[model samples]
Target: MVVLKKKEMMQCYTFFLLIIVVVASAIPTKADDQKKRVKEKSLSDASHSEDGEHNNDYDHEAFLGKEERQTFDQLSPEESRDRLGKIFEKIDKNSDGFVSEDELKDWIQYVQKRYITTDTERMWKDYDISDTNEITWNAYMKRTYGYGDAGEPKEGDPVYEYRDMITRDKRRWERADGNNDDKLNKEEFSNFLHPEDAEHMREIVVLETLEDIDKDKDGFISVEEYIGDMLSDQKKGEPEPDWVVNERKQFTDYRDKNKDGKMDKHEVMDWIIPTDYDHSSAESKHLIYESDKDKDGRLTKQEILDKHDLFVGSQATDFGEALTRHDEF
Candidate 1:
């Protein structure tokens, strides 16, 4: 009878041992399944990111790229805008709302950015007007564009619908080139801000746009390597200098006024034409009022075109006289 009891106890112990083993083996399998699920979810998230639907916030530091972050940090936005403005105004002819596509190309070349030939594919995507490989002011001021003017938002604006400085810029661009001209050719534009004014304005804008790219301590930008860099997702050098970074931030106050991403012409100009704003000649202003039959203080396309030749001839004469004076001096 004792032997029989011992055998029964052994069987009970055996069953318990088997149960323990099964539980132990099941625990590992369950844990592994959980881990696999988590890993698969992580992979799915990564795939979603690669599809480009992610809404990552603007990372200016990362945008600066490894090579330029050091220099970009050194200069302020004010200095950058000041420098770029000088270059832009110098090349801009019509003092109009926008720079012509050709002028912009020249500027890119001047800054050492990659150059796309006039006839290259999508070359005119930035400015093409008639599908004839030409650019027009109307096209330049496309309301849908980030830089295009869509007019101003008045007081008591809605929370989401309030227009900002980009809107103003678009409106300014449209108003400046009202004639639907293909481009602001050299003769059509002039500087609203002359040497001193242009200098101040340029400093303000350049600092904001091209800050910290000056690897060399020299005031002027040595190269325009940031075009490609800006388009990538890379970490730049150490933090930019306080002054240089400050200028960039300050320029953003104006360039990105209203919290929009780009600038338009309205923010750049005032209604008063400069006394020195010689549209071909110093005498052109005299004809401005004469042409405004409606007396609204603005010249129409026909009116400006009517005297275009006269203005051209007067300017030529003035240029000659100035040359003669310089020779005499």
Candidate 2:
């Protein structure tokens, strides 16, 4: 009788354990469903659509929509070419007209000046591959565009066709880097500059990016106009004047290892690379890619210093706030 009772107790314990496990497993699924529902609702709110009709806005454009094309018009010819080359190469990974995000990972890294200002920092945050912890090319493009098909509203549109010239220049840049060191030399910069065909291709991409952001039928992107459109969350009453208030908390957290209000741009850039400063000549720790400077196989401290002004210029969109926040960053 004692043995039989012990066996019955064991069975009951096993039954209870099974019930607990089943309940635990179900909670996550339920939570996930709720989270998805919430996300869907948020999208609907952002697009001002009912029944999630607005999600289709992303469907028509590969990277930017009609609303986004206007922003790139202000870029100079060089900036336009570099930026557009990246966009074209993003979608044409195989150097083919069509591509998926997976293939673009092997594409060569494009080196521009390191960002010392907030605008470039923001752009890098949105587009830079290493910072986002995503390795694939599609992920990089998606990070920049936030949607697909800037030219077409749906798949199979000729507007979805990728540019051939941009893809070639991107490939050429990658090929020139040879050793795959992230930075390029004076020779590499010259190669990109001297390419007669690259100029035309850059214009196409730069114009496209500008058109993506250039709203209000204006030829140029004024600070007020650019900031109003990019930063405004129509859902959240009036646009945010600057990103400072929004990122104020996070920036504060990262500021002042030395307890000063200022963050040294180089120090901040280094921190963005690997953990703490690892300045030993080890290849792994070097984060800044100085691809365009003199042929020394390295970017100088002065080059790193210029990033500050670019970032500041990009971020300080309003004159009043620009003046106030000039020294703050």
Among the numbered candidates, top lDDT falls to: 2
**Cα error of candidate 1 at position 109, Å:** 7.0
**Model 1 TM-score (2 dp):** 0.20
> What are the lDDT figures for the candidates, one per model?
0.27, 0.28
Q: What is the lDDT of residue 213 in candidate 1?
A: 31
lDDT of 1: 0.27
Q: Give the Å error, residue 173, model 1.
A: 3.5
The deviation in Å at residue 224 for candidate 2 is: 2.3
Q: What TM-score, over all chains together, does every model reach?
A: 0.20, 0.20
Per-residue alpha-carbon lDDT of candidate 1 for residues 121-226, written as tens digits (9 for 90 to 100): 2233433446454445444435233223323444553311324322432333333332545353221211100111122333222332222333343443321222
Candidate 1's displacement at residue 82, Å, is: 39
